[model samples]
Target: MTGWRAIIPLNLGRERKTRLAGRLSPSERERLVEAMALHVIDQLRSAGSVAEIYVLSPAEPGFPGTQWLKDTRCGLNQELAHVLGGERMLVIHADLPLLDANEVEALLREADKVGAAIAPDRATTGTNALALRDPGAFIPAFGEGSFARHRTLLPDAAIVVRPGLQIDVDKPEDLELALKSGATSIACPI
Candidate 1:
């Protein structure tokens, strides 16, 4: 079988919050974020199970073997459609360095049965990852309370709740937790 495909929307715009604001300088923080993204991409490639891997950004990411698609005005929803290509789509964030490829594979396998599945943050207030059998299922409402918004969008869609896979770096404390938890590889370039 061709299996499913994964698309990582790399929010490379400079406005992201500093995960290590107090511990690292501004330049170091930016570099750290970039490294984390590369690490996740590398792990995905190592799995060699997913059919395709694309990174969505305004500019082409320097990483090799990744399909770089220019982000549209609609943000993630548009990018999800471009990469999904009618097959099952696993929409993940590049900031999640500690993701288990097997978990991703499981999500893909499960997607074969369900219409959609989403991985929410620890707080269960925000969405960290989303999976859909149809690319059109993506409706971006990413913000403080996006978890509810997405659930509303896919009222009939199945939900696959995973904890570790849902951890995404956002605040400075999150970065420290990732590093201290030995999932630091998820913070560095793979």
Candidate 2:
């Protein structure tokens, strides 16, 4: 597998996990976000193929080996587009509670075969992890039904399905799924 940089975009403002409001308080939600982001950075650091890890956000998440970039807050796609010019990179969501080094390595391995690869959510509608040969190869569309949208845009990209990469905690059910999937305590309890 080729070496690649990982970019994680975190929106700590109103844009962060609004769907979890019914289950977790504002502070609890923030803690969860930070925890998951840290977990992702840690996993990337441990991954053999990961060269650098970058956290793009309004404020620093302060993980030990990550480079923090100031997020323009313009939107996920635009913010990502600003940082990705022509380098090979992996864009991972911050809410992936079950993410680990193995999953990242698997994704990169698949990318080596297909130039680009994406791990869609369990429902196969949302994109949780995306890898590209060139950052600008395709614009990232990461919201509702984004998996299908991304596939449409990058028809040649391989589809990698790993449980850890597929399970990003967004709703209460998602959190439960992560917990059942052996996700450790990265954040405090709701």
Candidate 3:
């Protein structure tokens, strides 16, 4: 049986996307967050290599075909560590609006070749997606220069470069890039 599962960590805080506050209103940011997260889940569902999809958040996202785990309101690393066990898993960020099923399949295929794999952001400083053959292989470092940090932890892990997976919406420029790349969400029309 396949032991691979896709785990998405969502920060369902009211202040989500604070970086975009200067441009978008609070309600708009919230809606965009929800829309992008749902889009990510949809893509993961369509990926044949993904055995299951799980959302780890403080509140229920109300998405079907996904198991929601009520997070402990702790930091990202701690929350992820709480759920890590003896299972092969892929940790995907919820902000990848352009993420597609084929990209996810390619990531899984790469992970199968290497014990672990990571897709770094455009700046090559942050990690957008991480796949591990064993969840407990290394402690997850997910903030600021995480790409290099994760590589330090798992030196042999493959570094994948997929355009769709790299464009995570964190700043105003990121949103613009995602929009220009044909990213569509239920909240904001393309």
Candidate 4:
């Protein structure tokens, strides 16, 4: 199978990661966003199975290796639906602080086997990473409780479970988990 292309949707706005506002200052949240996004991108690059990387956001985060696709303000689902390349599309969240190359490779291997794979967030309600062998066939339904939506849509999809792929920082508790996940970064260390 061909190497996968990773699609990372980064929220670069000042209010990015607003859920963490109570736990982190605005600047801290921004830094956390950048650091986590960069970490995800770094892992993707390290994965030999990933051939390319694309970042979808309003403003470029200045990550060097990724091709920044100017978001059309069309929202996540629509924007992802429009992305066209890559033998297969790997849609991964930027807040996955624990994500590493091993998870990326593992997810892709499962995708190669089943044509589709999903890594549910720690709570098992949302999707943290998705591998679509046929990108056009899936519309990228990511939001609260998205795991069930994708699961219902693609019943045959392989379910990939791993700490590196299952953890994502979104809430106050999630932030703590991320820090404990050996990611002592949230703007120069939490």
- Candidate 1 achieves a global lDDT of 0.69
In the order shown, the candidates' Cα RMSDs to the true structure are 2.7, 1.8, 1.6, 1.5
> Which pairs of residues have clashing backbones in candidate 2?
none
Residue-wise C-alpha lDDT for candidate 3, range 1-190, written one tens digit per residue? 4857988998775479999888788888888888898899999989988888899988887789999988888788888887876767899999999999999888877787888889999999999999988777356999999999999988988888988899999889999989888886733632
Q: What is the TM-score of each candidate against the true structure?
A: 0.84, 0.92, 0.94, 0.94
Q: For residues 1-190, write the lDDT of model 2, one tens digit per residue.
A: 3469889888755546778889888888888888888788888889999998988888776778888888877888878877876666999998888887999988888877777899999999999999987766367888889999999988889999998899989898999888888888544555
Candidates 1 and 2 compared by TM-score, better number: 2
Better of 1 and 3 by lDDT: 3
Q: Candidate 1: where is the Cα deviation over 4 Å?
A: 13-15, 78-85, 186-190
Ranking by lDDT: 3, 4, 2, 1
Off by over 4 Å in 3: 1-3, 186-190
Off by over 4 Å in 4: 84-86, 185-189
**How does candidate 2 fare on TM-score?**
0.92
Looking at candidate 4, the ten consecutive residues that score lowest on lDDT are: 181-190
In model 3, which residue pairs have backbone atoms overlapping below 3 Å?
none
> What is the C-alpha lDDT profile of model 4 across 62-131, one tens digit per residue?
7989999888888898888888544688999998888879989999999888989999988899999999
Runs of candidate 2 with Cα error greater than 4 angstroms are 13-15, 187-189
**C-alpha lDDT (0 to 100) for residue 47 of candidate 2:** 93
